[model samples]
Target: MLSIYIHIPFCVRKCLYCDFLSFPASERDKEIYAAALLKEIETEAFRYEERLVDTVFLGGGTPSILQTAHIEKIMDTLKNCYRFSSKPEITIEVNPCTVDKEKLSRYKAAGINRLSIGAQSVQDSELRALGRIHNAADFFAAFHMAREAGFDNINVDLMSALPGQTAERYLETLLKVTGLKPEHISAYSLIIEEGTPFFDMYGEKEGENGVERGLPSEEEERRMYEETGKRLEEAGYCRYEISNYALKGRECRHNTTYWRRHDYAGFGLGASSMVENVRWKNTARMQTYLDAYGKGKIHGNVKEEIQRLGRAEQMEEFMFLGLRLTEGVSRAEFFEAFHEDMEKIYGPVLQQLLDNGLIDTGERVKLTSYGRDVSNYVMAQFLF
Candidate 1:
């Protein structure tokens, strides 16, 4: 089975820390972009007629910013072009400030069954520091509106290690999120990407006046990750992946398909797709995408750069992606896929990690508390 990702690359205003390929919306551009997206969908549907699609995710610059009619148009286009499974999981990413009760109701009616709300933090000051427009009250209102609109499956996105975040504040934010009782929670550590405003401000201001302007220290970040796992699990939210927690059977099938190396198609400007062992991306510029689509440029900006997976790449990816799961990879599944014994492939590294109390291996190999704290390092050892 395959999953589909539709990129809505339009936002009301770009956030300070965001470096994604998106721009503020204009009436003409929105119409043009939506049409181009449908065209690309048609192109992809014809290209991959053999695969069954089970999940569809609409991520972006904040899909909530779109009007109900625009969303319905996209869904209608999908129905016309491709076949969806009986019960496909259709998810849309929403920002708190952009959604209202009416819009939420219309979204459910438009066939969106899942909502991923962007609630970075509950604290107003923290939200401002992160350059988010909404306050905590707005997020609460949006969450209630989603429930009122018949959305039972909801995911909340939270960020840790902000510019002025403290351990106590971060814990408070997590507790508040858990109190809301979402089905899924994705907690990510803030990374200051190079071109973003946060990066420029913090990167230039550091060490000038004893300023601590960047991300949290390595030690602090590790502590935050460890505490996050412990707290979420205690709240009855299982840590299915390093950065994600969910109740039973609530794991995101779309994202899991990627981690498991399943085929998927992506549409929109700057979107990437992996199908039939070939990976390619669309052009990033809006004008370029529209021009190519309007001119019947079927393979515009597409390049097939195929890298056949050898033993090392496959094994390394399996270990890295599998270890992201708290339950870890199954020994039977590993051997079935690779035709090699897991114990024979990297026995020394596993033994070293297990001996150091960083991982546990019984039925399935999983990260111990120490291992989760230093997961990147543990994953790095398996890369070669």
Candidate 2:
């Protein structure tokens, strides 16, 4: 399946923990960016004109910050440029403060069938501490507005392991969100990046300016993670993939494309695309992208970096990426795709993982719950 991603790198306020390319921008700046994005999409869509697009994800900084008409223009342009499935899973990532009921109505009218709302926490204090521009009330309002606007497929984005977060408090957010019964939910743990405010506050030695950030202790974070899974599982939301829970038949198809190693095209600022066995990332610098696109550089060569994968590279990626799924990678499919037995190349490693009780060696290999706890380390063993 072929999917598409559009990055909107404009946020109302950059959260303290954010390391994505999004930042605060004026309406005029966003409009200009959208225009540039349109140009890129119009030019690049032709390359995949023959492929029936399965999903189109409008991810952000915050896509809802765009005016409804701008969104409509982009969707219209995409429809004009490519062949989409009769029922494409078109999703837009929305920030609560940016969209009202009327705006949500406009979004529905504009063909956004799914909404991924960023509602990080339910506590007003945590919202402020996380640098979120909206309070819990704002999220509730936005969520109900989307429902009133007729969105049946919605995903609420939640974060755990935040500073000053307790296991009970985090569980409360999970329980409260699950009560809404959105079609999907994505929960992520806070990882401190080197340059962000979070890292600065917690990175240095305690004797230095690195006072306690009130970050959840590692053990508390582990409890939060376990409870997250247990609660969601009991709520009837299947843990289809790590970090995501969905009703059966309601997984985020666009993201699944990534984990399943399907081809996709990405547009807009700092987007990444992998098609025709080559992976490339767009230039992250806003002015740099604008300059190139402004000069008619929408072709494949416009990206910041492009790399072609060898057979070995592809196989490793297939194993690691597929392992991220609860179902794990299929050995038969691996042989069919690469024409080599997966066991032949990674037999020893697989045996080790199985012996350690980190993975199962049935018809397909999958991670155990213990494996998922050290998944980063487990997955890295696949790299050769």
Candidate 3:
């Protein structure tokens, strides 16, 4: 089954710590961009006509900012262009400040069954530090509004290791979020990305402010991650991925397609697509995207980057991505895919890691607690 991703690259304002390809909204640009997105989808539909889409995810700068009619038009185009699975999982990412009861209801009517709200943190201070437009109350109101609008499958995004954030505060935020009982929780550690305001204001100006004004240290971040896993487990949420927790049967299908290396289609500015073992991305420039579409130049947006993966690269990706799961990569599946036993390929490394108490092997190869703590280092060992 295939998955579809639509990027909406407009937000009210950029977050201080965000380096995503997005811009502030403009009426003229929004109108042009939406039309271009529709055109891009139509142009690429023929390529995936034989495939069935199991998941449809509308992600963005802020998909919730679009008008209901615009969203509906996009959905209508998708329905006309592609065949969906009998029980497709459709999701849309929303910013709390951009949505209300009416918009949420319209989104549901447009065939979006899942909502992923960007509620980075529920603390006002943390929100301000991250340069978020909405406060904690706004997020709560949006969540309630989404529920009222008949959305049952909901995901909330949270962040740990924020500037000036303490472990106590992080735990408190986690407790408050779990109290809401969302179906999915995505907790990511803050990364001070280059080109972001936060990186310039704090990261680049190192030594200007005390440690309290910067991101949490590696040790503290690791503690927060381990504690999060423990807390979420206690709350009946399974760690399906390193940073993603879900109630049983609530794992995100679209994201799973990615980790599993399945084919998918992406439309809109800066959206990346993987089809027929070929991966490509659209231009990130909004004006360029609109101009090309207006000139009936749909193919102009696509940049063919990786045509296919070699055996070594594929194996490396398979192990790394699969290891992100708590259950880890299945030895049987690896052999089936590669026609070689994983143990045979990396026997010495596996034995060494096991001897070092970094990995466990049974039906599958998985990182132990220590390995999980230093997953990046462990993954690097498998790379060719």
Candidate 4:
């Protein structure tokens, strides 16, 4: 089986803290891009005809911003080109206020079974500070609209550790979301990426004056993170992955396929795909991609940064990615895939991690609570 990711890299407005590959586009530009995407999907379908596609994720710069007809056409084309499984989980990522009840109802008719709403923060002040186009009331409207439109499987995306955000305030946001009890919740801490506005205000160069500038202190940030896990768990949502929580049976299967190192294809600008140990990413340049499709060259000319993983690389990935799950990596499955005993290869490293109380080992190996707190350092240990 395989999963498919379709990227729609257009948004109404770029947020201040976002560094994703997204931008504002005109309606004409969107029409042109959608045509190119359809051509690419048809072109790439032949190679994966033998596999059954079980999940389709429409992600990126607010897919819900598009006209309902565009989304319906895209889904129709996918159903035509690929052989899907008996029950496919089709999801679309939406921003509040970008979609109305009518648009959401059309999406349901088009076979979209899941909705991921980008409700970063519920506080109006925080939403404005982050430069979000939607306010708190818009999020509530969107959620209720989705329910009225018949979407039961929904995921709400939340973020913590914002500038001027306190732990108590973070809990307030958490409790408000938990009250709704969406099937899934993804809570992430804000990271100051180099190219975003938040970086200029809070990056290390200005760290000496950070506290005066309203950025949360390290103690407050850590407390916020701890509180997120505690509050979400108390609400009966299980933390199946570091940043993702779900009320049983709602974990995102597409994302889990990525963590388990399964074969999946990505379509659209700057999307990445990995299959049978070979990986490639589509060109990020918009006009370059359009020109390729114009010239009837969607297959080869549009692909870039292709690499084939060697055995060592595969083993490294098996450990690094699989360990991210709360259940950890399976030893028997590791041996079955690599044809070697995992202990024979990384016994010393495992022993060190075990001794340091960073990981626990049983039939499967997984991070301890403290280990997950410092997951970056723990995951880095798997690199060769």
* Best model per lDDT: 4
Between prediction 1 and prediction 3, which has the larger lDDT? Answer: 3
Off by over 4 Å in 3: 204-214, 217-219, 295-301
Q: Higher-TM-score candidate among 1 and 3?
A: 3
lDDT assessment of candidate 1: 0.83
Root-mean-square deviation (CA) per prediction: 2.5, 2.0, 2.0, 1.3
Model 2 segments more than 4 A misplaced? 204-211, 295-301
Instruction: Evaluate residue 234 in candidate 3 and report its C-alpha lDDT on the 0 to 100 scale.
Output: 97
Model 3: per-residue Cα lDDT over 1-384, one tens digit each: 789999998899999888887779788778778888888889888878889989999998898788878899999999999999998999999999889899899888989999999998999999999999999999999999999999999999999888878888999999999999999999988877778888776664334442556667667777888789899999999988878999999999899888878888888888898776667887776667777786556654455354677788888888888888888899999999999999889899889989999899988999988888788988888988
Task: Report the poorest 10 consecutive residues by lDDT, candidate 3.
Answer: 204-213
lDDT for each of the candidates?
0.83, 0.88, 0.87, 0.91
Candidate 1 Cα outliers beyond 4 Å, as residue runs: 204-211, 214-223, 295-311
Q: Relative to the unseen true structure, what is the C-alpha lDDT of residue 310 in candidate 2, on a scale of 0 to 100?
A: 94
As a whole number from 0 to 100, the lDDT of residue 366 in candidate 4 is 96
Candidate 4, residues 1-384: lDDT per residue as tens digits? 999999999999999898999999999999888888888998988999999999999999889888889899999999999999999999999999899999999999999999999999999988988989999899999999999999999999999878777888889999999999899999998877889887787676237556678878878888999988999999999999999999999999989999999999999999999999999999999998898775456554688999999999998999889888998999999999989988988899899999999999978999999889888888888888
Q: Over the stretch 131-207, how does candidate 2's per-residue lDDT look in tens digits?
A: 99999999999999999999999999999878788999998898889989999999888877878887777784223
How many clashes in each structure? 0, 0, 0, 0
Candidate 4 weakest ten by summed lDDT: 202-211
What lDDT, from 0 to 1, does candidate 2 have?
0.88
